[model samples]
Target: MPVALEIVSPEKLLLSRNVEMVVIPASEGEMGVLPNHAPMIVLLRGGTIAIHEGGKVTDRLYVSGGFAEITPERCTVLADEAVPTSELSRAEGERRLSAAEAEYNATDKNDVPSLDAAMDRMQSARAMIEAAAA
Candidate 1:
């Protein structure tokens, strides 16, 4: 049985379909979700979400960061930012990386939240560049 997968960003729903399997970049590491999986919620890292069907990966999406809710029959992703892997631009990623690095450097070390946000941006930008290359 296929599991229903919904990938949603703040702006719109990126994809909604039944996939044979879906791999997510969870904060703990990568995780594969299939039909009848246990219920849980996980924090997503900046990476790719691979949708598998017909024994192969059919779609790939890059997410900045997000939360994923998984149930026995479905998986839903609430993404901060998401786009098709093919749509990621290396040049844009590079530009964002540079900006994030500057922000990180300027942020006060004692301000944990600000530092973390900057770090997340840097990581997300790097992931976008890598995804574009693949």
Candidate 2:
């Protein structure tokens, strides 16, 4: 039995397919899910989600943060933000990185919330760039 995998963000449904396997960037670590896997829910971190079919990686997506629900026959990811690697451009990534850096630099050091948000954006932008390159 193939596992049905779905990835969604606030704006849209990123992916929906019956994949042979999937590797998610779980908060605990990378978790590989195959058909008939046990049920669970996991927090996601900033990283790639690899979709495999016939022992080969058929697709990859970058997700900033999310939660995933895993069951015996399906996996669903509700992401804070997500983008397919193929859709990301190097130039756009660079632009985002630069903008985030500039914002981070301008923010007051004493403002913890702003600093954290800026840092997260910087990291997400960097990861997207890397994923696009790969």
Candidate 3:
């Protein structure tokens, strides 16, 4: 049975269709959703989402802080920021990683949470770039 997935961004709809499976990056770790998946909600941490469809995996996305709402029939992701894997650039990813490191090093311990968040974003961006380049 096919599973429906809708990936939406504030500016646009990234994807909306039926798929066989979806592997998302949840705050705890990777979470897989399929047709008739149990209803639940998950907080997404920055990472990749692999979409499996029609005997092939056609899409990969970089997702930032967000929440995923799942139901028996469909899964919907509402993200703070989401970019298609194709949008990632190696140079840009490295630049972002450097900036995040700089910001983290320049901040105080009290700001560790925020710095860590930025680091996660940078790491996720890097991973996406690496995945695309492979």
lDDT of each: 0.96, 0.91, 0.82
lDDT of 3 at 107: 73
Candidate 3 local lDDT, 2-117, one digit each (tens): 88899998988888999899999898999999889999999987778899887677888887668999999999999877888788776877777687778767778688788777
Worst 10 residues of 2 by lDDT: 120-129
Per-residue C-alpha lDDT of model 2 across residues 34-111, encoded as one tens digit per residue: 999999999887778999999999999989878999999999999998988888787877898999999999999999
What TM-score, over all chains together, does every model reach? Answer: 0.97, 0.82, 0.86
Query: Which tens-of-lDDT digit does each residue in 18-68 have in candidate 1?
Result: 999999999889999999999999999899999999999999999999999
Off by over 4 Å in 3: none
lDDT score, candidate 1: 0.96
lDDT agreement of model 2 with the native: 0.91
How does candidate 2 fare on TM-score?
A: 0.82
In model 1, pairs of residues that clash are none
